[model samples]
Target: MYAIIQKFHSGWAYIALLVLVIAVVNAILGMASKKEFTAKDRKIALFGLIVTHIQLLIGLVLYFVSPLGLASLGQMSDKSLRLTSLEHPFVVIIAIILITIGWSKHKKLTTDESKFKTFSIFYGLGLVLILSRLPWSLWF
Candidate 1:
C-alpha cells in the first residue's frame, strides 16, 4: 500500500507540474499579447489547479504512510530526512495556497490583463516554490 501510494504521488507530480507550467506560460503569453481572457484560458488555469489539488491530496495521504514522510520528521540533522519530512511538504502547501488565492482573486478581477497578471504572478511563484523544495534525489 505504501509503495502504491508513493508511486502514485510521484507519477502525479509529473502531470501536475506539466499542467502548471502550461498554465503559467499561457498566462504570460496572454498578458504579453494583451488578449481578452477567453474560456480556453480559464480552462487551462482550471486544469492546472485541479491537477495540483489532486496531487496535494495524494501527497497528504502518502505523508502519513511513507517512512520518508512524517516518520522521519525528527531527523532534522539529516538533510534528506529533513527535506522529505518537513521542508518539502511545508513549501508545497504554501505554493498550493498561493495558487488557490490567485484563482480566487482572478474571479474578482474585471480586466483580462489583470486576471492574466494575477495568474502569472501567483501560479508562477507557486511553481517556483514547488520546484525549489522538491526532493530531487528521491524522485529521480
Candidate 2:
C-alpha cells in the first residue's frame, strides 16, 4: 500500500507541476498581451486548480501512511527525513493555498488584466515555492 501510494504521489507530481506551469505561463502571457479573459483561459486555470487540489489530497493520504512521512517527523535533524516529513508537505500545502486564493480572487475580479495578474502573481509564487521544496534527490 505504501509503495503504491508513494509511486502514485510521485507520478502525479509531474502532472500537477506541468499543469501549474502551463496555467502560470498562460496567465503571464495573457497579462502581457492584455488579452481578454475568455472561457478558455478560465478553464485552463481551473484545470490547474483542480489538479493541484487532487494532488494535495493524495499527498495527505500518503503523508499519514508512508514511513518517510509523518513517521519520520522526529528525525528532523536528518535533512532528507526533514524534507519528506515536514518541509515538503508544509510548503506544498502553502503553495496549494496560494493557488486556491488565486482562483477565488480571480472570480471576484472585474477586469481581464486583474484576473490574469492575480493568477500570474499567486500561481507563479505557488509554483516557485513548490519547486523550491521538492524532494529533488528522490525524484531523480
Candidate 3:
C-alpha cells in the first residue's frame, strides 16, 4: 500500500508541477500583456488547481502510510528525514492553501489585470514554497 501510494505521489508530482508552471507562466503573460481573462485562461487556472489538490490528497494519505512520514516524526535531527517527515508536508499544505486562495481571489476580481496580478503573486509564491521543500534528493 505504501509503495503504491508512494509511486502515485512521485508520478503525480510531475504532472502537478507542470500544470503549476504553465499556470504561472500564463498568468505572467496575461499580466504583462494586459490580456482578458477569458474562458481559456480560467480553464488553465482551474487545471492548475485541480492538479495540486490531487497532489495534496495523495500526499495526505502517504503521510499516514509512509515510514518517512508520520513514523519519522521524532527524527528531526536528520535533515532529509526532517523534510519528508514534517517540513515538506507542512510547507506543501501552506502552499496548496495559497494556490487555492489565488484561484478564489481571481474569481472575485472584475479586471483582467487584477486577476493576473492575484495569480501572479499568490500561485507564484505557492510554487516557490513547494520548490523550497521538495525532497530533491529522493526525487531522482
Model 3: what TM-score? Answer: 0.99
Q: 61 in model 2: Cα distance from truth in Å? A: 0.5
Query: What are the Cα lDDT values of the candidates?
Result: 0.97, 0.96, 0.96
Candidate 1 lDDT, tens digit per residue, 1-140? 99999999999999999999999999999999999999999999999899999999999999999999999998999999999999999999999999999999999999999999999999999999999999999877
lDDT per residue (tens digit) for residues 9-93 in model 3: 9999999999999999999999999988889889999999999999999999999999999999999999999999999999999
Give per-model CA RMSD. 0.5, 0.5, 0.5
Q: How high is each candidate's TM-score? A: 0.99, 0.99, 0.99
Candidate 2 Cα outliers beyond 4 Å, as residue runs: none
- Model 2 TM-score, 2 decimals: 0.99
Model 2, range 17-97, lDDT digits (tens) per residue?
999999999999999999999999999999999999999999999999999999899998999999999999999999999
Give the Cα RMSD of candidate 1. 0.5
Residue-level error in angstroms, candidate 3, position 52: 0.3
Candidate 2, residue 97: CA error in Å? 0.5
